[model samples]
Each structure stands twice: as C-alpha cells, then as structure tokens.
Target: MVYQLIKLLPIKHLPTLLGIAAVLTSALVAPSAQAQTKTHEGWYQVEMIVVARKDDTGQEHWPSNIKLRYPGDWVELKDPNATEVPNTTNNSASATATAPVVDLTKEAFYLLPASERQLNTQAQKLQRNPRFEVLFHNAWRQVITNKKESKAILINGGQTFGQHQALEGSIRLSVATYLELQTNLWLAQFDVNVGQEITQTWPEIPLRPNYTAATINNLSLDSEVEAELEQALANENPQWSNGNFDANAAAPEANNYVTRQIILLQQERDMRTSEVHYIDHPALNVIIQVTPYPSVATTPLPTAQ
Candidate 1:
C-alpha cells in the first residue's frame, strides 16, 4: 500500500520527500551518538599516591619517607587545576638550624580526545596556555606531614625525581586511548622509585654495618620508546604535523618529552573507575586511580509565597 501511495505521488515531490526522510534519519541517529560521547565525558575524581621505597638484601624500606597523596577531579581536558600545596614553615628549637621548605611542581591533567591529530594540536595549545600553570597549581597541593624530619624538598609533577635534585620529579596525567584503540584510558608518566644503593662498612666481619642511600637520577626515555609514542600519535591523526612544521621548530624539548610521556601512558592499559594502576620507574613508584563523581538529580524550586 505504501509503494502504491508513493507511485501515485508527483515525481518532483519524491526527491523532496526522500531528502526529508534522510534528514529525519540523521536527526534520530545524531542524538544517540552524541549521548554516547557525553556518557564518556564527565568529571572524574582521581587519587594518586607516590612513594619512595628501597630494598636491602630482600628487605624493603621507605628511605625518603615520601608518601605523598593527591586527590582531585575534572570534567574536561581544559578544566581548572585540581591540586594545590599549602605553604609551610618548619620550627626548630635551635636558632641556627635552617628552616625547611617544601615545593611542588604544579601540573594540570588533560584528557586527550580520542583523535591523535587533536591530541597533538591540543598538547601544543595546552603548553602555550598561561592558565595551565594555574590549573596545575590547583590540581596538585603539597601537605606538610612531619615538619621536624622534613627538609628542603621538591616534588616533580612528572612522578620522577629531577636531575640531581633529591625527591624531585614530575607526573603527567591524561585520558587517552590504548592498544589497537580498544579502550578509553587514563594514563600517567613518572619514574618509579624502586631500591637504593647500599654500602657495607666492614665487609669481612660476620655482622657488618651498612648504609642505605636513596639514589637520585633523572628519568630517561629510550629511543625505541620515544619512537613508539611518536608513531602512536601519528596514527591517531595522520595530519598532526602537516601544516605548520616550521612554526614549531623552536618548541622546547620539554614539549616533546611530555608528548612522548602522554603516548606512553595510553599504551599501558585501559582506565577504569576506582581501580588503581601502578607504574614502576627506577627512582619512584606511582599509584593512580580514576573515579567518576556520583550524579545528583536536581529538585524543582519552591514557588514564592
């Protein structure tokens, strides 16, 4: 009956009718796609803990006693900074003793869209944005635990110790895609502090005195790892570096370092809510988790009396 009705319709009207039908179909499909995307995008609460551990003849210990924790949440890649560290002063009985200070390397977490091309572009823009510093400062905060034992300390946002600086490194956090694009994930970059160097005072004695020391070193990314990250970014968006090659010529080496780290995190595993993921580096161990905030239904406002 429908076919007969269509046949009876004017020929010119058929084209218009088909176009309307196509539009209707698209309108129906578009909302479902958008809704799915929205479900994936939202504020996620995160908890990250970093600790420095050492091993001595099968015994483990925390030498630097670094048990730093950061709790935060964000809705978008460009969301406000989620961490902050309060300024603190050490009080000592001896007037001659130097007052200790703690400093945190401020950092912001960005969720890279699934598109590799967009990741590169966003990465460049994020680095250039002055607000990123503020965002980072807000996301990461330093809390003073033991004022007496604590000395001059620097914490890296990258999760690894800085070169020649004790207990100073960086941590890079982002949401990305993983392995064969099979999963949407959260990733982080940092050097994992494992064990320290030990020196024995009396080697010939049965019971010898030994000294355990925390080894400070910069996190090094091998060429193979760097190439893998570069390839992954290129695959996500084939035209990532197409138009403005020379414009980025003077880009700092740190930018490339961060880009590589972002890619490395994505390659590790899919991110799940409330599940902790540990990435081990030679100088530190990083523990991170992502949890979605519970949605609350809004109630209707009461009418004025």
Candidate 2:
C-alpha cells in the first residue's frame, strides 16, 4: 500500500522541493547588522566648466557652466546642444594636443592697450545689469548649497525721510573688481592676470573634504586663510616680471589687488552669515532691501498750530 501511494505522488514535486531548499539557503547567507557605509558607494562624479574673466579691479572671474550626473539621479546640461568629443589615447599620431590656454600664455599681458580694450568692452556690459543667469542645473545645486542671490548693494535714487536719498538695492556687482571702462581701465587688466592663477588654484584646494559639496563657512578656519589664499594666488600669477611683481607694477595694480581681496573677504564673510547656496549656480545674485536712511531736509515746515 505504501509503494502504491508513492507512485501516485506526482514527479513534478521534485522541482518544488528544490525551490524550497534554495529559499532556505538564501536565508542562511543573509548579512548581519554590523556593516558600515563604504567610500566607493559615496563617490559622486560632478563636472563644472569654468570660463575665467577679469574685472575692473583685475580680480579673477570664474564663470562656469556645470553639469553633474549620478547613477540614480538626473542632470540637465547647461548647453544641451554642446558638442562632445571622445578623448583618444591609443595612437601617438592621433593623440590630441592640449590647446594652450590662450588667455594666460598670450604674448601681451593685461597692461597692454589691446588687452584693456577687450576686457573693457565685456566689463561694461556686465555692470549695471540686474538679471539672474543660470550657471548649472543639476541635483548638485540641491546638494552643494551656494548663494544664488547677491548681497552687495546697488546704488539707486529713492525718496526717503521727505527727501531724495540713495537706495541700496542689490545687483550682480562683479564677483570681480568694479571697473569703469573709461578712466580706470587698467584696473581691469590687473585682475585678469592675477585672477587666472587664483581661479586655477581654488579648485585644487579641497573646498569640501567630507562630501562632493561643502559650506566653507561651516568649517572651523584660521584667520589667515584669506590672506594666505590671496598671497598664494599673487605669487603664482605675478602681474609683472622680475623678483618684484608688485614693486615693478604701477600703484594701481596693487590697489586693484587689495580691493579685490577685500571683495573676496566680504564674499567669504557673506557665505558664512548669509544664505549662500554654492551648488552649480555660478553668479552671486540676491535681492536685498536698499533701505535709504531718511534724508535730512533743510526746508523748515511752517510752525505747527
């Protein structure tokens, strides 16, 4: 009777038995609760293309169009139509030549008249403009958190305290030096030369060690950090030849450097105090109240009854 019952049981039950055995095996192979986060899992690739320019004060202007892509995230490239050329390294004859940085290696320096004219034409267009422009659009902006709004005051006339007063509104004052293209054009030249070196070094510094994006103000810092950065940049990209780049150049060059340093210092300070979002956004643009102090009116009102 037992042999007859076994024969009646279907042979297909063997596969079902194997499936149950596999489930039990997997259950036994599961991991424990002691695992930690791995660094390889944390590494995210982000890219920014910086186009450097000089301001009136000869400070470096790093305007970039950045794009970032993560395995699970989406990124919108600033220039969707921008061309992509694959780098080839296999053949010596076909090896691509690195284009020399024309802006830096160009024979004539900023002091030359032709360089001044080129910079002035561009600087004038940037100044007195209050529009917001996008630098990069990606999930990175959500991560890095740089300030999008400008903090610097924009000079505009408004009525306050029963008289006309200068209102302090916000504008896209060059993150670079403020140069009047006409009389003080040389100031712009000085910024270009020195700024080039500074911008290059800025990326080298691990601005954020912990993550792909970091807030510089949040970290504990030395008082000399600003001065050190400025000096390092000056030494790397000297304005003039000889052992004395500062001494050889005119007073305006030094002045421009000093002023630009001040602006940069202020920017650093603002990054700490103000709501700065550093992600992919390039320009510092924010709307601030230009509260004009009440103007003092000499015109006396008739005696009140």
Candidate 3:
C-alpha cells in the first residue's frame, strides 16, 4: 500500500518524498556508525630510562630505570588524589601491544621516526634556542662544590686538579589523540661538577615543567638535615659502617628523599599513547615511551555438567 501511494504521487512530489526518505535513512544509520567507532581509552604502560655521561668524551651510561602504568581514569579525572600503580608486565612479547623500549646505548633509538610532527618540530626549536641553560647553570653551581682553592699550592708551582663530572637526565612523554598517538612534552635535568674529589651530591632536579628554584631551595634544608642525622648516627654508633647501627635512625632521611621525589613525579603532566618526547641535557638523556596496554580476553564460565 505504501509503494502504491508513492507510485501514485506526482513526479514533483516524488523528489520531496525521496529527500525525506534519505533523511530518515541517515538518522537510522548514524547511531550505528557512531557506536562502531569506539573511543580508545585505557591504561598505558610508561617506561623511562635515565642515561648519563661523565663528561664530553665519556661513554654514555644508564643510571636509572622507571616503569609505571598510567590509568585512563586518572588522566580523565586529572585529580591529585589519583594513584598511579606500577606496571609489572614484561613488554617484549607483543610488539603490537605496547610501545617499544628505547635503548639509549644504541644509535637506532634516535633515528626512529617521530610519532608526532609537532613534537619533533618543538624539540628542534628548543635545541636551537635553549632558554633553560641559565637556570641549569645556576642549579648546577648551587649543588656542585668548587674546590679550586683547596687543591692549589703556591709552594709547588700552583698545582691544580683537572677532573670533572657531568650528570644528565630527561623525561619523555607520549599521548594519544583522536587521529593518532604522539609525543607531547619533555622535561630534563642536568648537572656538572668541576673540582677535586667531593662528597656525592643529590641534585635537586625538577621532573615537572613548573618546578621552580624556590621549591628546590626549600628542599635543600632537607639535605642538610639528612646529613646531620647521618653524622649523628655515625658518631653515636661507632660500628655503623659494620651494620651495627639502628636502622630506625636512618628512616627520616630516607623518607624525606622519597617523599620529595614522589611530589616531583606527581607534578608531571599526563601523557597518552604513541607520543614520543625527550628532554635533552648536556649530562643526561631521558627517553619516555607511552603505549596502550594490551587487551586480555575474558573466559566464559562453563555450564553445570
């Protein structure tokens, strides 16, 4: 009956009827298409490695390794209370499932095609015009001890020390977009000490972009307190070097360092999948890769036998 009604319609009216029919068809098909295009959101495995060089002529070295999982909920919520747990999965088995690890020792890592054009472009710009060098220089001077006078000797024709040490580390972040995954940002920390042998120094390096000199200055007090605690522990327990001292006495210093590091890490910006970013430093190189976690298949429960 509907076909007969349409067949009896005038030729001019048929075009209008067809247009309405087309609209109805599109309205019916739109939802299914939208449903088929799933929004890709999930936890991503983030791996970062800290590579360093002692000096300009020294070979590269890897001093630190970090692995963590970034949950989709945390990224979406952007809440400070959200906790990021560690990811224990070994990512080597499935190539398609996760981002490949960047080995800094190998030359191929730097040669890999950049996942995002903007990231590549920004990195080049930063390399060409580094505004943070002055900040780095000041931070290095504050942390590194200068022993130029201690080693000088006028009686022996003014002998001096020529040894120096350099430290560098960077953080790379990748994120996924609507069309593809790419690197978003890079944060780097670097330090160098030029003098005779001195005590090991823990440089107050910022892992986040907003980390400021004032915050580092405040954190310096913690180091002094830590040193006092260690000295007290050593003096009170002569056998501390032989492992006879109370471990409880060292808790405060350890806790202080860990807490501060956690705060710095928490301040870092979030990243997504396939984004490749690097923070460049004279002494340190950090590369971070972000990739989606592989989906696990759920097994169906068997019916009662």
Please list the Cα RMSD from the true structure of every candidate, rounded to 1 decimal place: 25.8, 31.6, 26.2
Ranking by lDDT: 1, 3, 2
Model 2 Cα lDDT, one tens digit per residue, 1-305:
22232355456333322322232232222233343232111111121111111212232353222221121111121221232354464567776644323221121111122331212322233232223221111111111111232122112221111111112111121111111000000000113233434532221111111122222332221324323334554666675324333322222222233111211111221111111112111122211111111223232211211
- Spell out the clash pairs found in candidate 3: 168-283, 168-284, 169-284, 174-272, 175-272, 176-272, 176-273, 182-275, 183-275, 183-276
Give lDDT tens digits, candidate 1, residues 37-126.
212433344444433322211222213222222212111222223323333444454434333222122222332223312123323333
**What is the TM-score ranking, best to worst?**
3, 1, 2
Off by over 4 Å in 3: 1-43, 52-232, 236-244, 248-277, 294-305
* Global lDDT of model 2: 0.22
| Residue 74, model 1, lDDT | 13
lDDT of each: 0.29, 0.22, 0.28
For candidate 1, the TM-score is 0.23
Error of model 2, residue 55, in angstroms: 19
Which candidate ranks first by TM-score, i.e. highest?
3
Best by lDDT: 1
Query: Residue 217 of model 1: what lDDT?
Result: 35
Question: Which regions in candidate 2 have their CA more than 4 angstroms from the true location?
Answer: 1-86, 97-305
